[model samples]
Target: MIRLPSPAGRRQFGVAVAGVLAFLGQPVPLTAQGFCFHPGPIARCSWFSVTEAGVALSVPSDEDPNLTFQAGALANVGPRSAVGGVLVGAVFQNDVRLGVRARYRRWLTDRLTLDVAPGILLYNGTFTADSPGFTGELALGYADWLGMTAQLDVVPFEFGTET
Candidate 1:
Protein backbone atom coordinates (compact mmCIF):
# COMPACT_ATOMS: atom_id res chain seq x y z
CA MET A 1 0.00 0.00 0.00
CA ILE A 2 1.04 3.59 -0.60
CA ARG A 3 1.66 5.78 2.38
CA LEU A 4 1.13 9.51 2.24
CA PRO A 5 2.96 12.21 4.11
CA SER A 6 1.28 13.96 7.04
CA PRO A 7 -1.00 16.88 6.35
CA ALA A 8 1.36 19.44 7.87
CA GLY A 9 4.30 18.13 5.83
CA ARG A 10 2.22 18.22 2.68
CA ARG A 11 1.15 21.79 3.34
CA GLN A 12 4.74 22.86 4.00
CA PHE A 13 5.92 21.25 0.78
CA GLY A 14 3.14 22.94 -1.15
CA VAL A 15 4.08 26.31 0.30
CA ALA A 16 7.74 25.82 -0.58
CA VAL A 17 6.84 24.83 -4.14
CA ALA A 18 4.52 27.81 -4.59
CA GLY A 19 7.18 30.14 -3.25
CA VAL A 20 9.73 28.80 -5.70
CA LEU A 21 7.34 29.18 -8.60
CA ALA A 22 6.54 32.70 -7.56
CA PHE A 23 10.20 33.58 -7.33
CA LEU A 24 10.69 32.25 -10.86
CA GLY A 25 7.57 34.03 -12.11
CA GLN A 26 6.00 30.76 -13.16
CA PRO A 27 2.25 30.35 -13.12
CA VAL A 28 1.40 28.38 -10.01
CA PRO A 29 -0.95 25.45 -10.43
CA LEU A 30 -2.05 25.71 -6.83
CA THR A 31 -3.15 29.30 -7.21
CA ALA A 32 -4.22 29.21 -10.84
CA GLN A 33 -7.99 29.20 -11.45
CA GLY A 34 -9.80 27.02 -13.98
CA PHE A 35 -6.63 25.56 -15.42
CA CYS A 36 -6.76 23.23 -18.43
CA PHE A 37 -4.14 22.38 -20.97
CA HIS A 38 -6.32 23.85 -23.69
CA PRO A 39 -9.66 25.55 -24.14
CA GLY A 40 -11.25 22.39 -25.58
CA PRO A 41 -13.29 19.91 -23.60
CA ILE A 42 -11.59 17.78 -20.94
CA ALA A 43 -11.67 14.02 -20.43
CA ARG A 44 -11.21 12.00 -17.28
CA CYS A 45 -9.36 13.88 -14.55
CA SER A 46 -7.01 11.10 -13.46
CA TRP A 47 -6.55 7.40 -12.88
CA PHE A 48 -4.83 5.08 -10.46
CA SER A 49 -4.24 1.48 -11.44
CA VAL A 50 -5.51 -1.15 -9.08
CA THR A 51 -4.04 -4.29 -10.59
CA GLU A 52 -3.78 -5.86 -14.02
CA ALA A 53 -2.47 -9.28 -14.99
CA GLY A 54 -1.47 -10.24 -18.51
CA VAL A 55 0.84 -12.49 -20.49
CA ALA A 56 4.16 -11.12 -21.60
CA LEU A 57 6.12 -11.93 -24.76
CA SER A 58 9.78 -12.01 -23.95
CA VAL A 59 12.98 -13.11 -25.67
CA PRO A 60 13.01 -16.87 -25.84
CA SER A 61 15.06 -18.08 -22.95
CA ASP A 62 13.04 -20.36 -20.71
CA GLU A 63 10.53 -23.18 -20.92
CA ASP A 64 7.62 -21.08 -19.78
CA PRO A 65 6.07 -17.80 -20.91
CA ASN A 66 6.44 -14.67 -18.80
CA LEU A 67 3.67 -13.24 -16.67
CA THR A 68 3.78 -9.54 -15.99
CA PHE A 69 2.08 -7.21 -13.56
CA GLN A 70 2.02 -3.42 -13.44
CA ALA A 71 0.75 -0.67 -11.17
CA GLY A 72 1.12 3.10 -11.26
CA ALA A 73 -0.46 6.54 -11.25
CA LEU A 74 -1.69 8.53 -14.24
CA ALA A 75 -3.13 11.95 -15.01
CA ASN A 76 -4.94 13.15 -18.10
CA VAL A 77 -3.01 15.52 -20.35
CA GLY A 78 -5.62 15.87 -23.05
CA PRO A 79 -9.05 14.72 -24.12
CA ARG A 80 -7.75 11.30 -25.12
CA SER A 81 -4.21 11.29 -23.81
CA ALA A 82 -2.87 10.47 -20.37
CA VAL A 83 0.73 10.45 -19.25
CA GLY A 84 2.24 8.49 -16.40
CA GLY A 85 4.77 5.95 -15.28
CA VAL A 86 4.57 2.29 -14.31
CA LEU A 87 6.57 -0.22 -12.33
CA VAL A 88 6.58 -3.49 -14.27
CA GLY A 89 7.81 -6.82 -13.08
CA ALA A 90 7.83 -10.15 -14.92
CA VAL A 91 8.02 -13.66 -13.55
CA PHE A 92 9.27 -16.68 -15.40
CA GLN A 93 10.64 -19.98 -14.18
CA ASN A 94 14.16 -19.08 -15.34
CA ASP A 95 13.96 -15.35 -15.80
CA VAL A 96 13.09 -12.27 -13.82
CA ARG A 97 13.22 -8.63 -14.81
CA LEU A 98 12.02 -5.34 -13.41
CA GLY A 99 11.39 -2.24 -15.46
CA VAL A 100 10.41 1.41 -14.91
CA ARG A 101 8.87 3.18 -17.87
CA ALA A 102 7.04 6.36 -18.72
CA ARG A 103 3.72 5.56 -20.35
CA TYR A 104 1.65 7.38 -22.94
CA ARG A 105 -1.94 6.21 -23.04
CA ARG A 106 -4.33 7.03 -25.87
CA TRP A 107 -7.97 6.12 -26.20
CA LEU A 108 -8.62 4.60 -29.59
CA THR A 109 -12.33 4.28 -28.76
CA ASP A 110 -14.57 4.65 -25.77
CA ARG A 111 -13.60 1.17 -24.69
CA LEU A 112 -10.26 0.56 -26.39
CA THR A 113 -6.93 2.00 -25.24
CA LEU A 114 -3.33 1.62 -26.29
CA ASP A 115 -0.17 2.10 -24.24
CA VAL A 116 3.33 2.69 -25.54
CA ALA A 117 6.21 2.71 -23.13
CA PRO A 118 9.97 2.59 -23.59
CA GLY A 119 12.36 2.17 -20.71
CA ILE A 120 15.20 0.19 -19.22
CA LEU A 121 15.22 -3.07 -17.33
CA LEU A 122 17.42 -4.91 -14.91
CA TYR A 123 17.74 -8.31 -16.56
CA ASN A 124 18.69 -11.19 -14.33
CA GLY A 125 18.90 -14.79 -15.53
CA THR A 126 20.50 -17.42 -17.80
CA PHE A 127 17.99 -16.68 -20.58
CA THR A 128 19.71 -13.43 -21.51
CA ALA A 129 22.47 -11.95 -19.35
CA ASP A 130 22.96 -10.40 -15.97
CA SER A 131 22.96 -6.86 -17.25
CA PRO A 132 20.90 -3.73 -17.73
CA GLY A 133 19.24 -3.37 -21.12
CA PHE A 134 16.64 -1.53 -23.14
CA THR A 135 13.02 -2.51 -22.79
CA GLY A 136 9.88 -1.57 -24.73
CA GLU A 137 6.26 -2.50 -24.39
CA LEU A 138 3.07 -2.23 -26.41
CA ALA A 139 -0.24 -3.04 -24.80
CA LEU A 140 -3.85 -3.12 -25.94
CA GLY A 141 -6.73 -3.21 -23.57
CA TYR A 142 -10.50 -3.25 -23.30
CA ALA A 143 -11.30 -1.26 -20.17
CA ASP A 144 -14.65 -2.66 -19.10
CA TRP A 145 -15.81 -5.69 -17.20
CA LEU A 146 -12.89 -8.00 -16.44
CA GLY A 147 -10.50 -5.22 -17.63
CA MET A 148 -8.59 -7.52 -19.95
CA THR A 149 -5.34 -6.70 -21.71
CA ALA A 150 -2.68 -8.22 -23.97
CA GLN A 151 0.89 -7.02 -23.88
CA LEU A 152 4.20 -7.61 -25.63
CA ASP A 153 7.42 -7.06 -23.70
CA VAL A 154 10.71 -6.85 -25.53
CA VAL A 155 14.32 -6.76 -24.37
CA PRO A 156 16.33 -5.70 -27.39
CA PHE A 157 19.83 -6.30 -26.14
CA GLU A 158 20.26 -10.05 -26.47
CA PHE A 159 20.48 -10.04 -30.26
CA GLY A 160 23.37 -7.60 -30.58
CA THR A 161 24.83 -6.38 -27.32
CA GLU A 162 26.66 -8.89 -25.14
CA THR A 163 28.37 -8.66 -21.81
Candidate 2:
Protein backbone atom coordinates (compact mmCIF):
# COMPACT_ATOMS: atom_id res chain seq x y z
CA MET A 1 0.00 0.00 0.00
CA ILE A 2 1.10 3.54 -0.71
CA ARG A 3 1.62 5.73 2.30
CA LEU A 4 1.26 9.49 2.32
CA PRO A 5 3.24 12.21 4.06
CA SER A 6 2.80 12.61 7.77
CA PRO A 7 0.70 15.52 9.02
CA ALA A 8 3.84 17.58 9.69
CA GLY A 9 5.24 16.81 6.25
CA ARG A 10 1.95 17.79 4.66
CA ARG A 11 1.88 21.08 6.54
CA GLN A 12 5.44 21.91 5.53
CA PHE A 13 4.62 21.15 1.91
CA GLY A 14 1.52 23.32 2.07
CA VAL A 15 3.50 26.22 3.46
CA ALA A 16 6.18 25.82 0.86
CA VAL A 17 3.59 25.86 -1.91
CA ALA A 18 1.98 28.97 -0.49
CA GLY A 19 5.37 30.68 -0.33
CA VAL A 20 6.02 29.87 -3.98
CA LEU A 21 2.61 31.25 -4.93
CA ALA A 22 3.40 34.47 -3.15
CA PHE A 23 6.64 34.79 -5.10
CA LEU A 24 4.82 34.10 -8.36
CA GLY A 25 2.41 36.95 -7.65
CA GLN A 26 5.23 39.47 -7.42
CA PRO A 27 6.88 40.92 -10.53
CA VAL A 28 10.46 41.72 -11.49
CA PRO A 29 12.06 43.64 -14.33
CA LEU A 30 12.65 41.50 -17.39
CA THR A 31 15.75 43.30 -18.50
CA ALA A 32 18.12 40.41 -19.05
CA GLN A 33 15.95 38.56 -21.51
CA GLY A 34 18.50 37.65 -24.07
CA PHE A 35 21.46 35.35 -24.36
CA CYS A 36 22.31 34.34 -20.82
CA PHE A 37 25.57 32.43 -20.70
CA HIS A 38 25.49 30.94 -17.22
CA PRO A 39 28.40 28.55 -16.99
CA GLY A 40 29.17 27.96 -13.36
CA PRO A 41 29.62 25.53 -10.51
CA ILE A 42 26.81 23.81 -8.67
CA ALA A 43 27.40 21.97 -5.41
CA ARG A 44 25.11 19.26 -4.08
CA CYS A 45 25.04 17.51 -0.71
CA SER A 46 22.59 15.28 1.11
CA TRP A 47 21.89 15.26 4.84
CA PHE A 48 20.40 11.77 4.81
CA SER A 49 21.40 8.41 3.35
CA VAL A 50 19.35 5.61 1.88
CA THR A 51 20.19 2.53 3.88
CA GLU A 52 18.32 0.39 1.37
CA ALA A 53 19.06 1.80 -2.07
CA GLY A 54 16.99 0.26 -4.85
CA VAL A 55 18.20 -0.92 -8.24
CA ALA A 56 17.26 2.18 -10.20
CA LEU A 57 19.89 4.34 -8.47
CA SER A 58 23.56 3.71 -7.72
CA VAL A 59 26.42 5.67 -6.14
CA PRO A 60 29.77 5.03 -4.47
CA SER A 61 28.60 5.32 -0.89
CA ASP A 62 27.50 7.88 1.74
CA GLU A 63 30.82 9.53 0.90
CA ASP A 64 29.74 10.04 -2.69
CA PRO A 65 27.04 12.68 -2.40
CA ASN A 66 25.10 13.49 -5.55
CA LEU A 67 26.81 16.25 -7.52
CA THR A 68 27.37 17.45 -11.09
CA PHE A 69 28.60 20.53 -12.95
CA GLN A 70 27.03 22.55 -15.77
CA ALA A 71 28.32 24.68 -18.59
CA GLY A 72 25.42 26.11 -20.59
CA ALA A 73 23.85 29.14 -22.20
CA LEU A 74 20.29 30.12 -23.09
CA ALA A 75 19.01 32.71 -25.49
CA ASN A 76 15.41 33.87 -25.39
CA VAL A 77 13.61 32.97 -28.60
CA GLY A 78 10.69 35.15 -27.60
CA PRO A 79 9.50 36.98 -24.53
CA ARG A 80 8.84 33.78 -22.63
CA SER A 81 10.76 31.03 -24.40
CA ALA A 82 14.45 30.18 -24.39
CA VAL A 83 16.74 27.53 -25.85
CA GLY A 84 20.20 26.29 -24.96
CA GLY A 85 22.51 23.35 -24.33
CA VAL A 86 24.49 21.97 -21.38
CA LEU A 87 27.52 19.77 -20.67
CA VAL A 88 27.46 17.79 -17.45
CA GLY A 89 30.04 15.88 -15.42
CA ALA A 90 32.69 15.73 -12.63
CA VAL A 91 34.33 18.36 -10.36
CA PHE A 92 31.21 18.02 -8.22
CA GLN A 93 30.91 14.28 -8.06
CA ASN A 94 32.89 11.83 -5.96
CA ASP A 95 31.89 9.53 -8.80
CA VAL A 96 30.67 10.91 -12.11
CA ARG A 97 27.62 11.34 -14.37
CA LEU A 98 28.61 12.75 -17.72
CA GLY A 99 26.21 13.86 -20.43
CA VAL A 100 25.01 16.62 -22.73
CA ARG A 101 21.52 18.00 -23.18
CA ALA A 102 19.49 20.68 -24.90
CA ARG A 103 17.84 23.05 -22.46
CA TYR A 104 14.69 25.17 -22.72
CA ARG A 105 13.27 27.75 -20.38
CA ARG A 106 9.94 29.49 -19.96
CA TRP A 107 9.46 32.56 -17.85
CA LEU A 108 6.51 31.97 -15.51
CA THR A 109 6.96 35.41 -14.00
CA ASP A 110 9.63 37.98 -14.50
CA ARG A 111 11.40 36.49 -11.51
CA LEU A 112 10.46 32.84 -11.91
CA THR A 113 11.55 30.48 -14.68
CA LEU A 114 10.99 26.85 -15.57
CA ASP A 115 13.65 24.80 -17.28
CA VAL A 116 13.57 21.42 -19.02
CA ALA A 117 16.46 19.69 -20.72
CA PRO A 118 16.74 16.31 -22.43
CA GLY A 119 20.02 14.71 -23.43
CA ILE A 120 22.12 11.59 -23.79
CA LEU A 121 24.30 10.04 -21.15
CA LEU A 122 27.77 9.68 -22.57
CA TYR A 123 29.44 7.89 -19.65
CA ASN A 124 29.35 7.26 -15.94
CA GLY A 125 32.69 5.68 -14.91
CA THR A 126 31.50 4.61 -11.52
CA PHE A 127 28.76 2.73 -9.66
CA THR A 128 25.81 3.46 -12.00
CA ALA A 129 25.54 1.00 -14.83
CA ASP A 130 26.43 2.71 -18.09
CA SER A 131 24.25 1.85 -21.01
CA PRO A 132 21.97 3.24 -23.71
CA GLY A 133 21.29 5.89 -21.11
CA PHE A 134 19.63 9.28 -20.74
CA THR A 135 19.93 12.49 -18.66
CA GLY A 136 17.92 15.65 -18.06
CA GLU A 137 16.40 18.16 -15.65
CA LEU A 138 13.04 19.73 -14.64
CA ALA A 139 13.57 22.67 -12.38
CA LEU A 140 12.30 25.97 -11.05
CA GLY A 141 14.73 28.86 -11.49
CA TYR A 142 16.92 25.96 -12.52
CA ALA A 143 18.72 26.57 -9.25
CA ASP A 144 16.80 25.35 -6.23
CA TRP A 145 16.25 21.74 -7.25
CA LEU A 146 13.57 19.89 -5.26
CA GLY A 147 14.45 16.50 -6.79
CA MET A 148 18.09 16.30 -7.76
CA THR A 149 20.83 13.77 -8.43
CA ALA A 150 21.24 12.40 -4.92
CA GLN A 151 18.19 14.03 -3.43
CA LEU A 152 15.95 14.09 -6.51
CA ASP A 153 16.71 10.92 -8.40
CA VAL A 154 13.30 9.47 -7.56
CA VAL A 155 13.16 8.03 -11.07
CA PRO A 156 16.73 6.96 -10.27
CA PHE A 157 17.25 8.54 -13.59
CA GLU A 158 20.48 9.46 -11.82
CA PHE A 159 19.30 12.65 -13.41
CA GLY A 160 22.00 15.18 -14.03
CA THR A 161 20.32 18.27 -12.63
CA GLU A 162 21.54 20.86 -15.11
CA THR A 163 23.09 19.16 -18.04
Strongest candidate by lDDT: 1
Residue 34 miss distance in model 2 (angstroms): 6.0
Worst 10 residues of 2 by lDDT: 42-51
Clash pairs for candidate 1: none
lDDT (Cα, tens digit) per residue for candidate 1, span 79-148 = 6765566666788875566655667778677567777876555443444433445566676767533344
**Model 1 C-alpha RMSD to native:** 10.5
TM-score of every prediction relative to native:
0.58, 0.47
Best by TM-score: 1
lDDT of 2 by residue, 2-121 (tens): 223335434544554454345334433354332223311111110111111112224545543444566644445455765556555543344455555566666665556677877655
As a whole number from 0 to 100, the lDDT of residue 59 in candidate 1 is: 51
Cand. 1 Cα-lDDT: 0.52
The RMSD (Cα, Å) of candidate 2 is: 16.5
Query: What is each predicted model's overall lDDT from 0 to 1?
Result: 0.52, 0.44
